[model samples]
Target: MTERIVVVAAALYDGDRLLAARRSAPPELAGRWELPGGKVERGETPEQALSRELLEELGVAAEVVERVPGEWPLKPPYVLQAWRARLLPDSPDPKPLQDHDELRWLTPDELWDVNWLDQDVEAVREAAFRGAGNCATSPNAPAPAPRQNPPNS
Candidate 1:
């Protein structure tokens, strides 16, 4: 059987707001919003891949917070997963330096405002639900568990 392509996405947050990005490439996906990330490289853990991807794509350092609860299928060979994350302390605020042409911080209520790529909708909803609770309201909320490689690596 063929191995499935695993992609990891960051539901990156600063308090209650999740960062959403607009795709700038591969013409078909351009202008559609997504949680910024890319395919996991062989031998790299999901956390490592996501951190590397965020640095390359957003020009900022990210600490993957926790994996969101479920996975979604992309086109045939690809499956997507999401994690909650935060910018590393003292990191520059993320800029859309690659892959993405625009960035916006959206509160849970605004989650549906952007035109997300269809495959990302369920993951986005899960992310919004996870972030909308106490995490959004309490500045003192405990940090999520430390990064671990995504399941089914």
Candidate 2:
């Protein structure tokens, strides 16, 4: 069986607002919004990979707080894992330095305003449900866990 590749995404937030990035490349995905992040390199932990990706793609430093509750399938052999993140106090504001062409900060109510990439829609919903103040989690649901490498890695 082919080994699965993990792509990490950040549901980066400030107060109650989440950051959304608009893709600018790979014509097919251009103009679609997504939670900014990238693939995990073999030797790095997901948290490390996420931080590096944020710096590379958004030009800001971020702290990956916890893993979002669920995973989504990408193209064959690639699966998406999202984490809740926050900008570091000393970091500069995010800019679309790479894969993205635009950035927007959306409050919980504005979350659906952007045209999110198809594969990212559910993950974004799950992230907001768990992290955004306006979206409540059920008492029976487990809290998001801190970053950890997936089992059997």
Candidate 3:
């Protein structure tokens, strides 16, 4: 059996708003919006990979607060996992540095306004459900402490 690979996605929030990134490459996925993140490289924890990816793809420093409760299947041998993340105080604003062409911050009520990638739909829903419950209304809200143990892939 082929081993499964984990793709960590960030349900990155600023206040009650979640960050969505629009793919700019890979013809099939281009133009669809999804959470910004990437694959976990061998030897790296999902949290570490997520932080690295957010910095690379969105040009910001983010802290992974907690894991979303469930996982969803992606293409064969790959699965998607989500974590709630927030920007660090000293980090720069997010930019479409790579793999994306546009970025938007959507409040809970506007989550579905953009066309989401099919594979990401359920994960976003799960993240939104969990995130909305935990999110604070003010952008200045303190971020939850990062979890000590990341969920197993």
What lDDT would each prediction earn against the true structure? 0.82, 0.86, 0.84
TM for candidate 3 is 0.86
- The true-versus-predicted C-alpha distance at residue 48 of model 3, in Å, is 0.4
| TM, every model | 0.85, 0.87, 0.86
Model 3 lDDT per residue over 75-122, tens place: 989999999999999999999999898899998766766778877777
Best TM-score among the predictions, by candidate number = 2
Q: Model 1, 1-153: lDDT tens per residue?
A: 779989999999998888999888988887778999999999999999999999999999988989998999999799999999999997899999998888999886666567788788778777777864643322233333322321120
List runs of model 2 lying over 4 Å from the truth.
136-153
Instruction: Please tell me which model should have the higher TM-score, number 1 or number 2.
Output: 2
